[model samples]
Each structure stands twice: as C-alpha cells, then as structure tokens.
Target: MNLVLIAMIAAMLIPMYEAWKDDNIWQKMLALASISSKAGIMTLFISVLRDDWMIGVVGAIILTVGNAGLMLLAHVIKRLDDL
Candidate 1:
C-alpha cells in the first residue's frame, strides 16, 4: 500500500514536468488540476492507512473543491485571453 502511494506520487510529477517543459497556459492549468487531484488522493490514502476520519474529511473536501477553483481560474484566464 505504501508502495502504491509512492508510485502515485511519483506519477504526479509527470504532469509537473509537462507543465514546465511547455509554455501553454491550458496545459499548465491541466497539470495543476492533475496535481490537485493526486494530492487529494494521496491524502485520502494516508487517511485510510491511519484510520483517521478528520484526515479523510479534509481529503474529501480537497477532492470535491480543489478542482472547481482551479477550473474557475482557468476559465477566467481563458476569458481574459480573449480580451
């Protein structure tokens, strides 16, 4: 299980690299979204491993809310880009 968590974390870096290697705003936004979700998943996994409901609740909130904010930001950026 720990190994799985490690692997998932390592996988999250791939998006970071892509975001860094390119200069596209949308791609960077996508990578940011991916990172957010992976972090939420990692948090959930840790919560499960520790059997802590508080951690799980925090993770659940991140999972539910994190991406919405990122997407809203992306939309704002897109709209600004059109102007």
Candidate 2:
C-alpha cells in the first residue's frame, strides 16, 4: 500500500516536469489536468486506507468534478488563442 502511494506520487511528478519544461499552453493545461486527477486518486487511496467516509466523499467529488473546471478553462484558453 505504501509502495502504491509512492508510485502514484511519482506519477504525478511526470506532468509537473512536462509543464515546467515545455512552453506550450495546451501541454501545460494537460499537465494541470493530470495533476488534478492524480491528486484525487491519491486522496481516494488515503481515504480507503483510513476508512474515512468524509474524505472519501471529498475524493469522489474531486474525481468527478475537478477535471470539468480545468477542461472549461482549457477550452476558454483554446478559444481565446483561436480569436
């Protein structure tokens, strides 16, 4: 279980590296989305391990709703770029 959390944390870093190294707006948005999802997943994992329902609910919310806002922002950015 600890190893799984560690692996997830490591996975999250890949996007950060990409966002840091690349200058593309799309890539940065994608990376931000990835990070958000990973964080939700990590929260879910921790909630499961701790047997906490409140935290689990929060995690579920993040998993379901977090990306929508990011995607909306991405779309706005894309539209602005196209203008």
- Name the top TM-score candidate: 1
- Tell me each candidate's TM-score: 0.92, 0.89
List the global CA lDDT of all models.
0.93, 0.91
lDDT of 1 by residue, 1-83 (tens): 87898899899999999899999889999999999999999999899999999999999999999999999999999999999
Tens digits of lDDT, candidate 2, 1-83: 88998999999999989789989888888998899899998998899899999998998899899899988999999999999
RMSD in angstroms between candidate 1 and the native structure over all alpha carbons: 1.1
TM-score of predicted structure 1: 0.92
- Candidate 2 lDDT score relative to the true structure: 0.91
Report, for all candidates in order, the number of backbone clashes.
Answer: 0, 0
Off by over 4 Å in 1: none
Off by over 4 Å in 2: none
